[model samples]
Target: MSLSPDVFTYVADLVQRRAGIQLDAGKEYLVEGRLQPLAKEAGHPRVDAYVRDLRVAERPADVQAVVEALTTNETSFFRDGTPFRLLTEHIVPALRGPNGSLPRLRVWSAACSTGQEPYSIAMTLADCVGPDTSVEIVASDLNTAVLERAAAGEYSRIETNRGLPSSMLVRYFDAEGTGWRVREQLRRQVTFLKHNLLEPPAFGGQFDVVFLRNVLIYFDLPVKRQVLEHVLAAMRPGGFLVLGAAETTIGLDDGWERVPLERGAVYRAVPRVPAWGLPTATSPVPVVLPAARGPLTGAVPRTAPPGVLPHARPAHVPAGVPAPVIRPITPAPVRGETR
Candidate 1:
C-alpha cells in the first residue's frame, strides 16, 4: 500500500530525532521497503498501517526496530574505491609522528554500516605500513544489529565478490560453505562499538584519520555541523577526514581545510575550539577555487549560490569528463523575412 503523508512524517520525525538523519519527501519507497518485513511480522497489511499503529502506542523495542530498519545502510568492501585510495596514498604518509616513524595510529570508521569498510581499512593499512607500524581501527555505527553482524566478520559468496579483489581474498578470508569468514588476526585489528554522532565523543584517544564517508548527506545543515563538531573533537589536529564523493564540509563548517588533491576530496581538521566545534585563530584560511563551467542561472545571478563556501562544488569532477556547456540560444530566423 502507498505510504500516507502522516506515516512518512512520523517515521521521518522519529529517525531525525533519534539519529539526526533527514528523510525528506519522495523517500516513501525507501520507508516502505525497509519496514515491509517488520510490517508483515507485526500482522499489518502495509507499512503505513504499522507506522500509524506505532504513532499511537509504540513500544521501546518497536521504536528501536523501526529506527534500526531505516538506518541500516548498504555497504561493501572498499565501497566507493576512491576514499581508500586517498587513505593509502596521502592520509597515512602525512600522519607520521616525530622522527618519521609510524606512531600508534588510530583511525575511526564512523557510521560503518557493516564489516567491509573497516576490514578494507585494515587491509589497506597492512599493505602500506610494515610490521613495525602500530595501527588501530575503530568502527562504529548507531544501529546495533548491523554492528553485531559487522563484528562477526563473515560474508556470503555474493557479498565477498563486491569490490573485494581476489588476491586479498585468498590472503584474508577463510573458506566456508559458499562464503568466507574474516580471519582472526585481521578481525583483531578492529573494534566495533555503538556511537551517536550528535553527542560528544571520547574514543580513548584522538584519532589520526577518520572515514566518515557518505553518511553526512542524510543530515540537514545543523546536524551536519553538530556531527562534524563531535568528529573534530575526537580527531587530532591536522587529522585527515575522508568524506564521500558527494559530501563535504564546505560552507557547513569552517574548521575544515579542503585538501587540494588531484582526485577525491578530503578535509584536514584545523585547530578548533573543542567546546563548540568552532575554529580557533590558527584555523587555516579558506582557499576559494576557480569558478566552475557553465553560465550562471537563476535570480541570484552568480556562478554558484550565495553563502556557498569558496571551495564549494561537487566534491570532484572526473579528470576527462568535459564541463557542461550552457549553449546560447539564437532566435529562429523571422518566418517570411528570413535574411
Candidate 2:
C-alpha cells in the first residue's frame, strides 16, 4: 500500500526531530516499506490506520518504535576498508603524544549501527596498539534495539561473510550455533551506549578520534550544521574526525581542517595560534610532529591550500593495491525487517 503525503510528512518530521535524519519528498516508498511491517505487528490492518492513531496521540513507546523502524542501520565489518587503513597506518601514528609517551586514544563511533563499525574499530586498535598503549571505543546509536544487538556482538552467517576475512573471523570470533559471536576479548574492548546525534554529546570527555561516517548524508543542511558543531565541541584539539567519503565540512563548519590521508577521509580540529607566533590548542595537540605543524598551525582557512595534499590518493585502487572492496555482499537487512 502507498503512504499518503500527509502521513509521510508527519513521520518525516518526527524522525528529524528525534534522530536528525531527513526524509525527502521522494522517500515515501522507503518510509512505507519500513513502517508497514511495524504497523502490521501493531495490529493495524493498514499503514495509514496506524499512522492515524499516532497522529491523534503520541505514545512514547510507539513513537520510539517508528523511529527505530525508519532509522537506517546498513553496516558491515570494515564497512569501508580505507578508513580503517588510514586509521591504523596514518592517523594512529600521528596521535602519539610527545616526550615519548604512549598515547591513550578515546574514539567515538557515533551512530554506530548494530556494532559492526565500532567492533571493526576495536579490532583495528587491538591490532595496532601494544600493551603500552590504551584505546577506549565509545559506540552509540539512536535506536535502543540496535544498541542491544550491538552490545551482544552476535552476527548471522551472512553478516559475518560480509567484509570479514576468514583469518580475522577465526581469530576474533567464536562460532555460535548458526552465527558468530565476537570474542569476549574484542567485545570487552568496546562500550556501546544509546545516544541521539541531534542531542549534545555526553560521552564524558573529548574524543581523540570521532567516526561520524555514513550518517550526515541522511540529515538536511541545517541539522547537519548543528550536528557537526556539537561534534566539533566534543573533539580534542588536533584530534581526527572521519566522515563518509561523500561527506565534508565545506559550507558546514570551519573549526575543522581536512587532514589528508592516503585513500581515506579525515579532518583535524584547527589549531589555534597565539600572538607570540607559537601555536596552542584547546587540548594537547597529539600527533602533530615537527614536520606536521606547518599544515596544522595557524588559522586554517575554509579551503585547503594547494601543494599541501600532493601525497593524497583515491579511496579505491585497482588490484595489486591493498584496498579491499567493503560494499555489502547482499542488501543490508532492510531497517524494519522482523528480527
Candidate 3:
C-alpha cells in the first residue's frame, strides 16, 4: 500500500532527526518499496500503520532499521579508481612522522557499508608497504547490519565480481562454495565498528586519512557542516581527506585545500595559525599542490576498468588466474611535459 503524505512526512522527519539523512517529498515511493517488507515482518501488515507505530511508540531499533534501509550503500571494490591510485603514488609517500620515519598510519572509511572499501585500502597499502608495516584501517557505518557483514569479509559470487579483479580474487580470497571470503591476513588490517557521523568522534585516535566520500549529499546543510566538523576534529594536523568527486570543502568548510593529482583530487587540512606572528607548535604549513582538474562531476563515471564497477558486475567469470603484482599507479604525463 502507498504511504499517505502525513505518514511519509512524519517518517522523513524522523529519519532526518535521528540519522541526519534527508528524504525528499518524492521519496515516498522509495519508503514504500523498502519499508513494506519491514512492516510486514514487524507484523504491522502496512507501511502507514508501521510509520504510525514508529511515531507513537518511538522504538529505537525500528527507527534505526528504517534509516538503514533508506541509506544508500552503493559501493564496489575501488568504486572510483583515481582515489586509490592517488593514495598509493602521492599520499602515502608524502606522509611522515616527526622523526622522519614512516609513521604507523591509521585510516578511517566513514560510512563504509561493507568490507569492500577498507579491504581494498589494505590491498593497496600492501602493494606499497612491507608485510610488517603498521597500518590500521577503521571502517564504520551507522547500519549495524552492514557492519556485521563487513566484519565477516565474505562476498557472494556476484559481489566478488563487482570491481574485484580476478587476480585480487585469487590473491586475497578463499573459495567457499559459491562465495569468496577475504583472507584472514588482509582482514586483520581492518577494524569494523558501528558509528554514526552525527555523534562525536569515538572510534579512538586521530586518523591520517579519512574517506568521507559520497555521503554528505544525503545531508542538509546543517548536518553536512556538523559531520564535516566532527571529521575535521578526528583528523591529525596535515592529514588528508578524500571526498567523492562530486563533493568539496568549499562553503561548508574552508580549512581544507585541494590536492590535484591526475587520478583524482584529495584534500589536506591547513593548520590554523594564532593571531600572533609566532607559529603554533603542531600546525605545519600546508603543502600546495598543482591546479585541480575542472570542477568535479560528483558522479562516478560508468566507464572505469573491469574490476571497479560502481553499479554492476561482469557477465562472465575467469577462474584460477594468479594475482598479478600490483604496480604503483602514477598519473598520465601531459602531452608537452617531460619527466
Candidate 4:
C-alpha cells in the first residue's frame, strides 16, 4: 500500500529532526520500500500503523534504525579516481618535501562508509608515499553500523572489486576465503572514529587533507555551509579539501581557493596573509627530530617548533600527469530549508 502524504511527512520530519537529513516529497516510494520490510518483520498490518507506533513510542532507537536503513551508503574503493590520484601524485609529495624532515602526515575521510574510502587512501599512501613515511589516516562516519564494518577492514571480493586497482589489491590485502582482509600493517595506519559532521570533529590537530566527498549533497544548504565552515577551520593552511565531482564551493566562501588538478578538483586554504606580506627574514627555523624510525618516520617532526609550519612533501605526480589548472571561484546557490 502507498504511504499517504501526511504519513510520509511525519516520518520525514522525524528523520530530519533526529539525523538532519532531508527526505523529499518524491521519496514516497523509497519510504515504502524501506519501511515495508520492517513493518512485516514487526508484524504490523500496514505501513501507516508502523509509522504511528514509531510516533507514539518514547524510545527513539526504532526511528533511528529506520533512518539508518533508509540512508544511502553507496561507496566503493576509490569511488572517484581523480581525488586518489591527486592525493598520491601532488598532495602527498608536496607535503613530504625534499628534506623528508616531516615525520607524520594526517588525513581525514569524513563520512567514510564501510571503510573503503580510508582503506583506499591507506593503500595509495603506502604505495606512492612509500612504507618509510609516517602517515595517520582518520576515517569517520555518523552511522555506527558502517563505522563498525570500516573498523573490521575486511571486504567481500565482489565489494572489493569496485574502483580498486589490481596492483593495490595484491600489495595491501590478503585473501580470506571469498573476501579480502586489509593486511595488519596497512590497517595499523588508520584510526576509525564515530563523528557527526554537525558537531565539532574530535581530532587533536588540523589535518593536511580532508575528504568530505559525496556527503554534503544529502544536507540542506545551511547545514552544508555550517559543515564546510567547520571542516575548513579544521584544515591547515595549504591543506587540500576534496568534494564530490558534482559538488563545488562556488559562492560558498572565499577562504578556500579552487585548485584544479589533472585527476579532478580539490580546494586549498587561502594563505592567512597576502603573498606580498610573507616574512622575508632568513632567520634559521629550528627543526625537531623524530623520536624513532617507524612506518611514518619521515612524515612529521617528533616535536614542532613554535610558529614553524608543519612540513609536507608534495604528493608524487606520476609521469605524464597533467599540471594542475587553477580556476576562478563561482558563487554557491542560496541555501533553503526543506521540510
- Residues 239-321 of candidate 2 have per-residue lDDT tens digits of 89999998998778888888877556699977544333222333234222232223433433333233223123234445344
TM-score of 1: 0.79
TM-score of every model? 0.79, 0.81, 0.80, 0.77
The candidate that achieves the highest TM-score relative to the unseen native structure: 2
On residues 220-324, what C-alpha lDDT tens digit does candidate 3 reach at each position?
Answer: 999999998888888877789998988888888877888876646588876555433223234444322111232213233333233333332223434333322
CA displacement after TM-score superposition, residue 95 of candidate 3 (Å): 0.9
Give the Cα error of residue 134 in candidate 3, in Å. 0.4
Per-residue C-alpha lDDT of model 1 across residues 1-339, encoded as one tens digit per residue: 679988899999999998999998999999999999999999998998889888888888899899999985889998888888888788888887646688588999999987799999999998998888888999999888899989999899899999999999999999988889999999999999989888876566488889998899889999999999889878877899989888889999887999986567799987643242222235332222333544334422443334433333444655444432222223344688657
For each candidate, what is the lDDT? 0.82, 0.81, 0.80, 0.76
Stretch of 10 with least lDDT, candidate 1: 323-332
- Stretches off by above 4 angstroms in model 4 are 98-101, 271-339
Model 2: colliding residue pairs: 94-287
* Residue 63 in candidate 4, Cα distance off native in Å: 2.8
**Which regions of candidate 1 are displaced past 4 Å?**
273-339
Candidate 4 lDDT score relative to the true structure: 0.76
Clash count per candidate: 0, 1, 2, 30
